[model samples]
Target: MEIILWIGFYFLTFYAFLPALVSRIFGFRVFTKGRSDSGIALTFDDGPDPEYTPKMLDLLKRHGAKATFFVVGENAEKYPEIVARIHEEGHILGIHNYVHHMNWFMRPSTVKRQIDQTSDLIKRITGTRPLYYRPPWGILNVFDYANLGYLQIVLWTSLFGDWRKKIGPDKLYRRMKQKLKPGQVFLLHDCGSTFGADRDAPANTLSALTKILDDGKEKGYRFIGIDEMIAVTEQAKKKNKSRQAAKGSEARGQEERVAERKSSIGPIKKIVVSLWMLWEKLFHVLFKLRPVGDAHFFNYRVRRYSGPPLDLRNDRTLRSGDHIMEIHFENQMLFEMGMKSKTSLQLAIRIIREIEKTLPDLARELAVVPKGDQVKALYGVSMIHRGSEGLGFETFELPKGLFARLTNVYLRFLIRVIHPTGNQRVREHSDTLNPRMLIMERNTLLEWADESRPNRRPNRERPVESSL
Candidate 1:
């Protein structure tokens, strides 16, 4: 019996007695305060009183001061207009439970209900979720702290024990001044814990509040709400973290991957890249085959890059997100035939003539792709059954014969209108198209070939067999 009694006593002591003891002895943080001692947050609890709250608001307004008010849900519901007024006047509201009790020692379900009810009530009244919450007396045991994040836990740096009448206005003010610091959150009372009290508590608080604000202003202290206080602290912490990261990066002897401002874009290199861009753009315009959203087109336009060679035999691989494009023998021909030339654009022009001779009747289709239709879904792959030994991509062919159309347009424009060249095939070793190399995007040459290899098409919605 004695052993059981001792266990019960110990548990009770830790639950009930420890809250006050911890608050008094250790002053341990239930949550961290603002990073600096340069600001003040004046918070009041147990408010929305018909008698005291209005007076407090008026006094605060007169001094051009704002505060965070933590009020009970029952009191808030009874006087919702007061709650709305508090929010309208630019003061933040926080949860202080539905009823004032030693809730920290209560069961988890009881505490959860208390918090949820209070949060809902405050949110409904003010049309905003209360950002902060404080269990009565800044106390929480094992179960009390569970899911406290439903409304964040906040505790004051200084509580003047203004709830007691004997402390009086004068004594409370003295305690407040003594405990005051730059980042201190001063806790005071606006109304009685239960409903119906003498106006003494609020009156004393008003007197104390004026003195503190006056003193704070003289010391160049900014009075902020709990939200601002938390935000400022978080900002300070992030800045400090960034500084530490910079130092660590410096220690590692590696700077962040910021673009280096080159002194000059070399004369020859700039000219070459510019000409290549012009040639590529014209190729797309003339052919009427713009790449699927950026992809090679975007890379050429803005983020310029050139692969070693092309692999036409690859499957349609995911280039960027969902858009897929054709991988052809153009890059291989460029590297093998045009690589010896100083300018790539000149060699590209030569290759266009050779492609025109290979397929003489090339022209732009002049038809717009149907809206909301995928290219692969709309056009089936046209399998040209020429033997693999002679042709580059034996089974790889774009639907609607796009390549043939592009070649015809190139030949007509270049041969008849502008300049002419010998239509000889630019031959290169098969090793030029490296199977493992990602010709464009993240796909290897072989992967691109596989997708273009053609397979059974996805099942289409056939007019809903019987839409009864």
Candidate 2:
């Protein structure tokens, strides 16, 4: 608990107070300021708000100044007219993120969805893709850097807490004036999330922006946009590229040494790979099985069942000593009873036969109920399969007997030690018919079970981005 608290505290302090430092260290070199002579590039976040954006625009127009608005994608879609007007009025449209959630908390997929969706919407309306992205709350993770590599990341150099309601307009102006430096990027909020505390952000920020613009005009700080900031960043990167070029000769020598080392290890690596292949071949020979059409598919050829035979006639629990049995067969009747249809019973019988022919280990004690059924018991897990177009698999349960306890034990270990496979374990689907059960994770008989074959294909989810 204490460790968690410490981590949480550290995260809050780092992101809240040292965002630029964090970004710099994490390989996300967001522009915290424009060029020293470019004056402060003005930018607004979470806007084009109907109530305050038009008013803000009028103020900017009257002041004869230009600023960038990093508008949310959802809001942009909600009010494309406002987005179109922002583009028409000559303000730079940067993506502030689709939703106003903090960047630190979002997954890579969510971030991608947010940026791509928002950029597409803005581009559709304005015919220009966004070139700049300002992370919400100036907090970013490593994944954000990797994903947002194409766009220039912009962070603020100066912020006067305009979002806090307690900070009055005069104080806000004073704070901005105090931090007002050449090339400083100003952090000011023009809107807040609908899910968050309103705090009258739009109104408060308008007042602060007014004070800054007026004071900035008097102080001769030219209000620029992200383009200037991008120029500065690119210029620096170009210089770094030039410096790195000076080390290219040494880098080539290092690459040559690496190639020589790889050449030395190449023969030994091939020998090891050959040995592994030989060992795999031996295992296949032991099972009298071979890889079928696909390299992944394994099938057995023998049918007489020369492997260890299973005794399935008894439901009695084998006893060891002290009223303690190594394996219990009780309470597992839930599976036998769970088979509601004849098809399910048939599938179970087929799965057991496959196990008997292929993997003869746990098949030793396997059994099916009812002597008239031809098969005494079913072994292995029953995976759910939906009708033909595709199918999905759920968890695999153990069969009956000592191996049932052992299978349960094995599964418990898998659950505890091995990482969960999640939905990736299953594939294929059909929506027209109700789902049915198919046994997965079998003996050498896996290739014989064609229903289980559908689980091998990959499942592509619905496209996240919609048609514009």
Candidate 3:
């Protein structure tokens, strides 16, 4: 009976108690995901050790790749310069806790102290605090994660269990290579896995890195930091959130404006002016631009994703000084007063004519599609105006056309002078875009103005007689 009870106790520890302990201690969280279709994350934990970090940094430099090292507080203090070197080389250093203790064995105070001390040391060395944390031996606890909300909880998708010496480098390398995939965060150790003793595993880790690098190159994988991965993911989330908020806000706002238009003049103008001013402030904050004239533009600076076309040179030898302006207006009254009652169709024709005159060759290459069937449908463009003077443009969809690639170039003047809300539709569409402008040396609008005058004969004759 005694033997049987002992056996049952062991089984309970393994099956029930251990897993529950593990789950509670290491609250389930993924550090990095879906940041890159072609990028892999190389993460090191329980490190900043002298025996290996310098060499690893050297190897990474040779390969021209960056890795994130999760340094133990004690180790970072021992080799502050080595940690500094990691930062100087453009790599990332994240916290692996100070003492590298097991959470289940540690008190809450100890865990907090360990995290804080190590973070302070890293900051003192690198000038920027780490925003990512990896638990020693993958033993993360719920309280740990909750307390460390500022840091991301990183868990490995593939690891060689490389701290064990028994595993040969070949096996370790093969295991890692086979499991590697785009968007995977791989776990490797710099000094050794926190789990002590297993001779083959630790050395094999460094050995495996060379092969991992080569194999990843073969597979077209790029490597990025955990912070970068999480940032991109967060941005996508924020954009979606912002978009939803914008749609709801705009829809409700429009309805309110319509209702008020039928009822009151007393408060509506103030409301419009307030809304316009708010958007202007938002744009200024987001893009750091103060509008000039009646022209206001918002620029999106997206990192990590492929950006829009950057070439600003006049295509097809169009003179540098030539300029063209295309204005989009929802109100016919404003549109007419701004440009002498010119219809959108007529304006487009006149602008196209100016382009042809500036660069006759491009004119020959240009295929002007008929009015009703624009070469491609334009992206959905909306103008929101709450009152007579409050107006702004929101762009969402892109119409497919030959001009799609060049649309960003020609779009500067068309953006309305209005305040901007973080419109989700616009953010989602413009996520990977960059700020750009096209220069036409001679302002096409000016040329067209001169051409639009009928003959200029009677006024010219009167001026000449006065001069004589």
Per-residue lDDT of 1-468 in model 3, one digit per residue for the tens? 999999988865654445434553233454534445677888887777777788788888888878889898988898999999999998888888888777656766788888889889999999999888876766754467567868876776556567777767876776676556776688887876355845234567878888888888888887777777667667768887888677887777765664544353346544654565555444444543311111112111111212232222123232222222222222222222223212333443333332223332211111211121111111112222111111111122343455555664323222221112112323454544432222222222122224455641111222111000
Residue-wise C-alpha lDDT for candidate 2, range 115-139, written one tens digit per residue: 9999999989999998899887777
lDDT of 1 by residue, 298-349 (tens): 2111111222222333344322223233323332233234323323235434
| Candidate 3 residue 211 C-alpha distance from true site, Å | 1.4
TM-score of each: 0.48, 0.46, 0.46
Q: Which stretches of candidate 1 lie over 4 Å from their true place?
A: 13-29, 193-199, 242-468
Instruction: Output the better candidate (1/3) by TM-score.
Output: 1
The alpha-carbon lDDT assigned to residue 277 of candidate 3 equals: 50
**Residue ranges of candidate 3 with Cα displaced over 4 Å:** 1-32, 193-195, 198-201, 235-468
lDDT, residue 312, model 1: 32
Return whichever of 1 and 2 wins on TM-score.
1
What is the lDDT for 45 in model 1? 88
Which ten contiguous residues of candidate 3 have the minimum total lDDT?
385-394
